[model samples]
Target chain A: MKIILDAMGGDNAPDAVVRGALEAAKEFGVQIVLVGRGADILASMKAQGWDTLPDGVELANAEDVVDMHCDPAAVVKQHPNSSLVLGARMLAQGGGDAFISAGNTGALLTAATLLVKRIRGIRRAAFSPVLPTKDGHAILIDAGANAECTPEFLLQFGCMGSFYAQKALGIESPRVGLLNNGAEDTKGDPLHREAHQLLKRAAEQGTIHFVGNVEARDVPFGAADVIVADGFSGNVLLKTMEGTAMFMSDMMKQMFYRNPLTMLGALLCKKGINGIRKTMDYRETGGSIVIGISRPVIKAHGSSDDAAIRGAIRQAIRAVESGFCEEIRANIGQMILPREEEHAE
Target chain B: MKIILDAMGGDNAPDAVVRGALEAAKEFGVQIVLVGRGADILASMKAQGWDTLPDGVELANAEDVVDMHCDPAAVVKQHPNSSLVLGARMLAQGGGDAFISAGNTGALLTAATLLVKRIRGIRRAAFSPVLPTKDGHAILIDAGANAECTPEFLLQFGCMGSFYAQKALGIESPRVGLLNNGAEDTKGDPLHREAHQLLKRAAEQGTIHFVGNVEARDVPFGAADVIVADGFSGNVLLKTMEGTAMFMSDMMKQMFYRNPLTMLGALLCKKGINGIRKTMDYRETGGSIVIGISRPVIKAHGSSDDAAIRGAIRQAIRAVESGFCEEIRANIGQMILPREEEHAE
Candidate 1:
């Protein structure tokens, strides 16, 4: 299997990406194609004591890095040889089985849909990631992929989320829940009410285990393995959790370091505290799989380190090994009958 | 000032309530009316010794306790002598300066709205609570009262929130922000877009200290002193924060109990840890204030103890002393002049 890495993507990009890919190549024995400006990638590689490319690693030269401020569509259209663009193209052309980037999320999603394309029956792609919880983890889909979505789109999210959790997270018959204002069908807006009906129908037919509406409070408790919402709410929910974790970490530090005595206590329990921090760290989770794509495409964090890069590469190899893309294609093809009425909209 | 305490409310109820109220009465020199079944209240009071209802404390005649499962509106209407209803009535009739209860939230909100009534200029009432954060705390209004709200409602929430912060939290010209998908007014749904415009107008005219849109990620950073959102989103946001906190607390506990060495370290810093826990404890923050009411009405936690009840009474006294209700009325009254003409359907 071959994986293409956008070495210019995150905050700690070239160094982290190079190191991660090298680690992944050694462990997984899979070819890694690092696509970026040749000189920078090579310098990063040489700095790490590599006289030449490893047997499993190769370079696909691209000239530019997309600035955070640049218009995503125009940049992708114009900068054909940009690292992100070239890396995406490699996956589309069968040069690599999977693609990974931590660059502009909007651009990554857009490129995946437009270039890497979607499974035949998919209406929209979702950026679902598993949220950590006491019971375990729950899948939150459409974490800012499509701002607006239909009931049909939500029903599909349930199907896709359940498939991913079942394959990757080792959950069987994962219960899917619609993220809503209330647990009752009569409690939400017209859109949620309609989606609730569709999900109920899907559950009846056994496509996915629909557990009805789940309030935000229930999401972090792992009340349901899969929770589906529109991109706007999902994105806000995901970020809120992340920001809150960061906030608590800061507060815990202040609480410990308030005085010399507690500061000593902090030192004594640093190992235990570090364990909690590691569990909360998103970088260890690999990249969010751009589900509904024809091939595996993972979007790592921009600040990803060497460990994160390797995680992403391993994620790609696992997806291929587990036949994730094939499972998605089969599920959508079998369950979703293209409705002419939807197309008319 | 006299405060009504629903002795039957909360998890630890009578014992915690009895001890907490006794401590507060002795410390704060405030009159306490322990309103519940006479026998239970008297028994608990006697347990703490120095009988005869004290000089400042008295018992109001209230019979049955409002259970959590009871229908809020039905119970409030049918059982006029229920602990919560009587407490609200006492506050409304000036029999007591404030009302505090740890009974059913729905029942409290219902009875308070029906019996106590809202401030003259306020259309909707909001539940504003000070949520714990890394940077001390931040106030979130309209946590979960009215699910569907207009832009006008959101603007009023800002006014009420700002007043509470300035007077109660002791912040000058408290920064007010509308919770949204992004900072831009053009972002988010039509409701959020309209709210952004209204908040901008309020800021321009000096009605509020509108600092524009603040995302969920910024909530923990002290980005704004008050976060204004419709009840649905606000409730979700509030619960999400709570769930995260609880989840973290549970994880920390597990880590502390992992080994004998860690357990020993936990014991050494037990006092400091207790202080940290107290700081993070939402119970210490008292009850959610039902803002926009004619008088100070506090809805204590359903599982509140006597300490929480005492804290709620103190919070109510502070609310009254801070002139929060009056300020909300004044601010909202000014906005009504032009709004009456341009009511959005």
Candidate 2:
């Protein structure tokens, strides 16, 4: 399988991305296609004592770079030759099995959907990010990808999220949960209530394992394998978790450096603390996967380092290996679109 | 100001409630009326080495106790003499200037609204809680109080939340931000979009200081003094913050006690860490003051201990002394009611 990497996507681009790609290629033995400005990629390669591209590794040239502030749809349309857009185009045309970018999320998402297109039966594409928790990890879908959604769209998100969890996370029967105001079926607004009923019916038919509504507080504790929420709430939850993790980590550092004795204690437990930090790091899990598209496209964090870029490439590989797109297409195609049409009316 | 306390509420019950009330009464020089089984209050009183009931401290007999499982509205009607209901009633009827309860939140909110009633022009009441953040604190308004709301109702939340911050937290021209998926005016669903427009209008009129939309990640860093969101989203944010705080606190404790050296280090910084813990403790800040009510009524945490219950009582006194209810009535009354009516049509 071939994976295209945006070498200029993240903060520590080229070096970090190239190094990470080399590591992934060495370990996974998958073809690594670095897509970026030609000279920059080659210079970085030469700096690492590589005169030429190694076996199982190739370079794809793209002249221009898409900055983080670029308009997603406009950039993809105007600069089809840009690395970010071309990466997605390559995947669509089967030049590579998957594409990864740690550039502008908006551009990445737009390129994936507009270029690669959504799978048949998929109402909308959802982004699922694996959140690390005490009990392990849980997937939160539509994490701010599409802000507004109908009940049918949310149902589709659940199906897509569940399949991703089953195929990628290796969960036998992923417990799917609807993120709602309360656990009761009658808890949320009309959209949530309708989705609850649909999910209940689906669960009864064994289409997906529904665990009912899980509140935001339970998200960090790994309440379910696939936690589906509208983008508005899911975005808030995701950012809140990220912000809290950073805040707590900062506070811990302060506590450790307050005095000599505490600093000593910090040093002693460095390994354990590092373990916890690693668990919370986004790079370790790769970036969020833009699910429901016809091809695998992963979004790396804009500020991601080479490590994160490489992680995103690895995730792309995993997505391809797991047949994520195919699974989503299969599961989502079963939904009745007639009700959705009526609801729109 | 005379404050009524529900001694029968919370995990610690009469013991913590009685002790906290006595302490608050003595410290603040405000009358505290403990409402519960007289025997339990008196028994705990003697154990605390009190020779006589302090000045401005008294008790009101209420035989019934509202359990966490009881239906909120039903309980208020069924148990008119229940501690929680009677306590709020005292504040409503001018028997007490304010009321405090660390009981069932649903019960507290129901009784407060039904008995105390909204101020003449106040449409819906709001529950505001101070969330701890790295940048200090941010007020999350309508935190699960009014789930479904019009944009105008949310505008009132911003105003009321701003009032609370200016009076309580002492921020001048406090920044009010609408919590949404993204920071753009066009970022969120219809509710958020309309709310953003209303906030812009309010800012233009110089009625309330309005900041642009803020994301959840910025919430922990005190992005704005008053963070306005619909109750559903607000509640989720509140609980997420609470859960994250608890999780971090627990993890810190576990880290400290993991080894003998770390345990010794914990001992050395015991005073400093305790100080931090005390500040982070929601008990110290008391509870949400059901804003827009005719009188001051604080909804203490359901699991509050003696210290927390007393803190709630004191918060009631502060709310009354600061004329928080009157301020909200005067500042937010006109806008809030008319907005609700307009949205109803």
Candidate 3:
């Protein structure tokens, strides 16, 4: 299987992306097509003491670069040869089985949606990010794709998210939970209340495994395999968790370095601290997968390092192999109830 | 000067409530009125070996208790003499300057809104929780009060939140931020976008010190004095932070207790750890204050210990002394643009 990487993306792009591609090629035995400026890619490879391109690796030259601040809608028209757009084009044309980028999230999502297109029956593509939990990891869908979602959008998110969890993470009949303020069915705003009923119906019909409402506090405790929410609330929850984790880690570090005795304690506890940090690290999960699209498109973090890039590659390979999109296309009908019938209720 | 307490509320019940009220009276030198079953209050006081009630302290009899599971809307009619309802009635009748409860949040909100009433022109009461930040604290308004909000409601939340921060927290000009997914004005759903425009106009009019949009990640870093969001997102952000904090603390504890070496490290770093813990403690901030009401009404945490209850009392006293509600009433006109003009815009 061939995977396409956006070489001129992310904060540590070109160098880190090239190196990670090489590592993934060598370790995973997958062919990697790096799309970026030809000279820059070669220079980055040479910087790492590579005399020539290795086997199972190739390059697709693209002259332009898409900055983080670029408009998502304007990227396709303006930066036609940008690495992000080129990579998406390559995947769309069947040149690569999957595509990955660590560039502008909006631009990437736009490119994937416009280029590869959404699945025939899918209403909108959802961004599903895997977050680490106590015992396992849970997938938070619609993390930031559609900020304003209807009940129908959320129902599709549940279906798509459950499919990804089962195919990618290998969670059979993944438990799908609606993210809400409280665990009661009566909780949440109008959208959630409506979505809850729709999801409950879908679950009863065996479209997905529907757990009851899961509160934010219970999210980190492995409450469900797939936690579904509108992009607005899901984005807030995801970012808040990230911020709190960073704050606590920084506080712990400051505490440990306050005095000589504490510094000594820090030294003694280094192993355990590292373990916890590793558990919380995003590099392990690679990035968020854009679900409901025609093809697999993984979005690595913009600040992704070599390990994160490699993780993204692994995720892309698994997505391609699992035929996750096929699963969604086959089962999404059962998840989405007809609008007329929905309104009739 | 008088503060009413629902002694029959919270997980700790009459014991912790009585002790906290007694401590608040002694520490703040303020009058206290404990409302609960008369016999239970006396027994709890006796259990604490306080043969006589302290000066500036009194009790009001309440026949029923509002349990956590009770419906908020039903509490007023079903349990009219419940501690929560009776306490609100006391504040409404001018028997106390402020009311504090650690009972059912929904019930407390309902009782306070129905009995104490909303400030003139305020459409709805909002739950504003003071969250501890690295430097100081920030108030998250509409934390869990109104799940579905109009642009008008959010504008009021901003107005009320700004005033509360200025009067209660002593910020001369509190910076009110609209909680959103992105900092850009163009970002977020329709509601946020409309609310953003309204808040911006309010800020331009010098009604609030509006600091554009604030993402959830920036909330913990004290990006704004008042972070205003619809209750759904606000509740999610609040709970996600709590969950993340708990997860980190638990992980740290597990790491420290992994072996003797780490345990020794933990002992040596106890002071520093305690300092960080204290900084992150919710007890220091008391609890969420129900803003937009006629008088000060503070909702303490259900599982609050003595310290949390004491903190809540201090907050209530501060709110009452600062004339927080009066401050909102006096300046709310400027904060809320005329509805006709709002529609015109």
Candidate 4:
């Protein structure tokens, strides 16, 4: 299998992406096509002591760079040769099995939707990010992809998330939970209430295993395999988790650095703190996948390091081998609205 | 000078409530009126070694109790003499300076609105919770009170939150931020975008000190004094913080207990950990205030223990002294929409 990676994307781009692709190529036995300014990629690799490109790894030169502030809608028309758009085009043309990027999320979503395209009959593509749980991880669908959503959109999110969990994460009959303020089926506003009804109907049909409503407070407890939500709430959940983790980490550092005894305590429990970091760190978990797209495409965290990029590549390879998109296409009937047609973004 | 306490409301009432009121009355130099069934209050206090009501403490007999699952709309009518309703009624009748409970949130909201009433011209009563931030705390307004809110409601939340932060929290010209998915002005759905515009105008009009858009990740960093959001997103943000705190606490416990060395480490650094707890604990922070209400009303956490309740009572005393409601009433005109006559929830 071959993977297309945007080496020019993310904060630590070129070096991090190139190094991660090399590591993934060696470990996963997959061909990696690094898309970026070819000379810069080679030089970054050379700076890290890799004087030449190794086997199973190739370079795709794309001169233009996609700015983080660039308009998503205009990326296709304006920066056709940008690394992000070119990577999407390569995946669309089947030059590689999957495309990976850590560029501007909106730009990538647009490129993926317009160039790589969504699965047939799918109304909206969802951003499914795997969130850390107590003992495992749960997928949060539409984690800021489509801020406003219809009941139909949520239903589709539930279906797509279920499929992704089962295939990519190897969870069988994933429990789909709707993220809400309360646990009752009657909870939430009109949108969530109506979405609950649709998801309930879909569950009865055996398309997905629905576990009533899951509150945001119970999200990190691993109560459900897939937590489906509109992008707005999902994004809040994701970012809140990030903020709390950061706050606690800072507190922990301050707590340890207070005096001599605490500093010694920290040294003794370094391994244990590493365990906590391992569980909380997004760097270890890989990237969020753009669900409902025609092909596998992963959006790594924009600040991801080389090791983090390797984790994302591993996630991408697993996604490719899992045939997650095929399952979505085969189960498309379950995702569509009964008699209503809507505009697809 | 007098605080009415719901002696039969929370999970640990009337034991915890009575003890907390006793502590608050002694420490904060405030008069306490404990409202509940007289017998239960006496027995619980007696069980805790208090044979009679202490000096500065009094009791008001209320025969009924409000269950957590009780409908908020019917609480006043069905349980007229319940602790929560009686407390709100007492505040409305000027029987006390403030009322506090940790019972059914809906029930409390109903009592506070139907009996205690709202500030005139205010469209909605917001549940403004004091969230722990890097340095101090930020108030999250509409933190699950009105799950569905209009842009006008959000504008009011900003105004009310700012006033509360300035008066109750002792901040000057409190900065209000609209909670959104992105920091950019054009980031969220129509509701948030409209709310952003409204908040911006309020800022220009010198009604609120607007700090533009604040993402959930920046919420814990103390960027703004007040974070105003529609109830749904605000609730998600609040609960997500709780969930993350719980998850981290659990992980820390397991990490400390991993081995003898880590166990000793935990013992040595116990004080620092307590400092961390002091920063993150909701118990230390006390209750969320019902903003836009006629008087100072606090909704303590449902599972509040004696210390937590004591903290809430102290908060209530501060709110009463702060003249928070008077400030809201004085500034109510700026919160009202020009021509939109919406139903007040």
Candidate 5:
């Protein structure tokens, strides 16, 4: 298997990206095509004490970088040769099995959607991130690919996310839930009400395991394996979790550093505390996947280091091997509304 | 000031409610009218070792209780004699300075909106909860009052929330921010985009401290004093915070209890750990106030104990004395869209 890695993306690039790609190529036994300025990639390798490239690793030269300050819509047009745009183009042409980027999220997503393209019947591509839950983890779709969405779009997300969870996360018949203000079927705005009915219908047809509406408060408690929402609400949910996790960690640090006794206590409970940290760590879950695209396009965190990039690459390999996208493509018929009257709106 | 409390509401009901009312009357030097079944109130008081009704304490017989399982829209009509309904009516008729309920949130909101009514010109009442932050706290408006909202409703929420934070929270010229997916003027769906402009206009007109858009991630950092959101997003933010905090606290407890060494560390740093708990404590913040109503109507946590009820009563006293509602009433003309074309939506 081969993966296209955006060598110039993310904060630590091209150093972390280069090293991560090399490590992934050797460890995962996959061929990696590193796309970026060849000079910088080589320089980063030298900085990390790597004198030569591995046998399975190759470099594809792309000089420019996508500027985050530019408009997301105009990124691909403005920086045609940027690593993000080029990597996406390569993936589109079947130059590689999957693509990975940790640079600009909006730019990467924009490039991927416009270049790699979504599935034939998918309404919109989505950014799906696996969130750490009390029991294990749950997939949150549309973390911010489409700010506004229709009921049909939500129905598609439920189906697509369930497929991703079942294949990539190794779950069987994943339960899908609509993220809403309340769990009641009758609760939420008109859009949610309609979406709930559609999801319920799909569940009745046995297309997916629709678990009804789920409140955001119950999300962390592992209420469902797949949580579907519009980009706005999903983004809000994802960011709130990030902020709260950081805040809690900060508070815990303060608690542990209060005095000598607390310091000793922290040392004694170091193992347990480390376990909590590992569980909440974003990098532990690897990169977020931009689901519904024609090929696997993973978005690593902007500040990702070599370890996170390596993890993202590993995820890319799994995504490519899972055939989740093919499943979604084949089951597209079940993701849409059958009512003609609904389409008129 | 006299505070009317729904004694037959919340998980603890009469036991916690009556004990809390008696405590508030003694400690805060305020009169409290406990609304519930007279016999149950007396029984609770006696159970708590209170031989008689204390000075400045009174009871109004309310034979019925609002059931949360019933339809929220039909609550007042179904439970006209309920503590929540009677308390609201009493507040509307100037029978008490303020009213508070730890009962069904929907029923309390419905009763307050229908009986007390919103200040004239107010679009919709909002549930404004004061959320704890790293620095201090921020007020999140329209937590779940209206699942669906217009730009105008959001605009009103901004003005109302600003006034609320300034008066009740004792913040001078409190900064108001529209909750959004991104921290940009052009972020979010159409509702947020238009609301952002409206809030900017309000700020330019010197009506409020509009601080542009605030993402959910920035909320816990005390980014703004008043975070305005449509009810759906606000509820999501509020509940997400609650869930994350609980999840973190639970993890910490597990960590401390993991082994003898960890237990010793926990004991050593008890003060700091307690401090973190106090900061994140729902009881410390008291109850959430439904803003824009003609009279102050507070919604305490349904699971509140005697301490929490006492805290809610103290908050009610502050809300009644602050004249925040009057501020909103006076500035109603400013919290609207100026363009006619936008109103047509």
Candidate 6:
């Protein structure tokens, strides 16, 4: 399998991206096409003591680079030869099986939708990221793709997220849940209430394993395997969990470093603290997968380091190997047809 | 000051409520009127081995009790003599200066809105809770009151939350922020984008200290003193924080009790851990204040203990003494007038 990497993206850029690509190529035994400015990419590789591209790895030079601050909607149009645009085009043109980028999220989404395009009958694409929970991890769909969503959009998210969870996470029948303020069907705004009816119907048809409404408080308890929400609420839920974890971790550090006695305790408790930290770390979960696109597209964090990039690459390989996109394409029609047919009837 | 308490509310009601009322009456030198089933309240008081009611404390008869499962909108009419309804009526009749209940949130909001009513010119009342942050605390308005909101409602929430933060939390000029998916003005759904423009205008007119959009990730780091969101998002944010904190705290406990070595480490780090726990505790911050009401009303947590009830009483007294309702009423006109006039013009 071949994977295209946007080496010019992210804060660490050429250095971390290049190192991660080399590592991923060795580890995954898959061909990696690194796309970026020729000079910068070569300098980064040389700085790492590489005379030439390593085995299973190659470089595709792109003249332009899309800055993080540029307009996402306009990047593809303006920077036609930018690394992100070129990488996406490579995946669309069958040069690579998957595309990975740690760039501006909006730009990536824009490129994916405009170039790779959405699956047939898919109204919108969603960003699904695996978030840490108590037992394991849960997929939060539409993490920040579309701010405003209709009930139909959310129902599609539930189906897509369920498929992603089953194929990617190896869950036999991932329990799909609608994220809401309360567990009752009557809870939440009109969108959620309407979506609940559709999700229930989908569950009844056995297309998706629909769990009832899951509250934000129950999310970390692994209440559901695939937690589906509109982009706005899903984004808020994912970020709030991240922020709270960060705040608690920072507070823990401050407490340990406060005085000599606490320092001694920290030393003894280091293993356990590290254990919890590792569980909470985003890098361990890899990058967010942009679901609903025709091909697999993974979005690494903009501040991704070498390990995060490697993680993203691993996620890309998994998506490609699992044939998750094809699975979604095959199952989504059945999942959505009943509702539409019922409406027509 | 006189405060009305719904003794028949909450999971630990009657017992915790009576004890807390007695404690508040003695500590704050305020009159406390416990409203509940006459016989049940007396039995709970006697069970605590209190032969007589304390000075400045009394009881009022409320024969009915509103269970948590009932519909919030229909609670007042269905159970007219319920403790929650009676307490609200007492506040409305000027029988008490304030009302506090650790009951069903929807039922409380229904009773308060039906009885005490909204402050004139306010589109809707909001539930403002002082959530813990790194520095101190920030007020999240419409925490779970109105699940659906218009731009006008959120703008009013900003005004009311700002006033509450200033008068109650003592922030001279509370920075009000619209909670959105991104910090950029252009980010978020149409509701947020429209609210952002209005909030910006309010800041320009000096009605509020609008600091523009605040993302969920920044909420825990003291990003803004007054965070304004529609009830659905605000409820998700508030509950997610609480849930994350609970998860972390539970993990910390598990880590400490894992083995003998870790247990000793826990002992040595107990002070610091307890300090962090105290900082995250909701009891320390008291209950959520039902803002935009004519009179001060507080909704304590349903599972509140004596300490939480006491905290709620303290918040109620603070609200009553601060003349917060009058403050909101006085400035609400200016906060809302410009938007209406602008549309008209």
Model 5 residue B136 CA deviation in Å = 0.7
- Candidate 2 residue-wise lDDT, A96-137, digit = tens: 988888788878888888888988778788888888877778
How displaced is residue B185 in candidate 5, in Å?
1.4
lDDT tens per residue, model 6, B1-345: 899999999999989999989988999899999999989988988999988888899899999999989899999889999999999999999999999999999999999999999998898898888888899899999898988988888889998998888887789999999999998889998889988988898899889999999999999999999999999989889989988988888888888887888888888888889889999988889999999999999999889999999999999988988888999989977656455654642
Look at candidate 1 and tell me the lDDT of residue A230.
80
lDDT measured at residue B114 in model 5 versus the true structure, 0 to 100: 96
Give lDDT tens digits, candidate 4, residues A2-110.
9999999999998888888898899999999999998899899999999888999999999999979899989999999999999999999999999999988999999
lDDT of 3 by residue, B231-295 (tens): 99999999999888888888899989989999999999999889878978989889999999999
lDDT of 5 by residue, B1-345 (tens): 899999999999989999888888999999999999999999989988998998999999999888678677898788899888999999999999899999999988889999999899887999988898999899999899998899888889999988888888899999999999888688889889988987898899999989899999989998899999989888989999999889888888998888777788788879988999999988889999999899899999989999999999989989989998888888888875556745576
- How does residue A15 of candidate 2 score in lDDT? 81
Give the Cα error of residue A155 in candidate 4, in Å: 0.7
lDDT of 3 at A243: 86
* Whole-structure CA lDDT of model 1: 0.81
> Candidate 6 versus the native: TM-score?
0.98
Please give, for residues A210-267, the per-residue lDDT of candidate 3 as tens digits: 9989999889988899999999999999999988888888889898989999999999
Model 5 off-target regions past 4 Å? B338-342
What is the Cα-based lDDT of residue A293 in candidate 1?
Answer: 89
Q: Count residue pairs with overlapping backbones in model 5.
A: 2
Model 6 chain B weakest 10-residue run by lDDT:
B336-345
TM-score of 2: 0.94
| Candidate 1 C-alpha error for residue A75, in Å | 4.7
Give DockQ for candidates 1 onward, in order.
0.43, 0.54, 0.85, 0.83, 0.86, 0.80
For DockQ, candidate 2 versus 3, the one ahead is 3
Q: Candidate 6 on A151-174: residue-level lDDT in tens? A: 888888999888888887899999
Q: Which stretches of candidate 3 lie over 4 Å from their true place?
A: A342-345, B341-345
- Each prediction's interface RMSD? 2.2, 1.9, 0.7, 0.8, 0.9, 0.9
Candidate 4's error at B270, in angstroms? 1.7
Q: What TM value does model 4 have?
A: 0.98
Clashing pairs in 5: A10-A103, A265-B265
lDDT of 1 by residue, B1-345 (tens): 887777777777777877777778887899888888888888877887847777788888788788877777687678888888888888888888778777777788888888999887778888887877656778888888877778878888888888898998788989998888777667677777887888888889888889898888889777788999878778777878877877777777876787876677677667756766786677788889988888888888766766677788788778878988778776666555375635653
TM-score of chain A of 4: 0.98
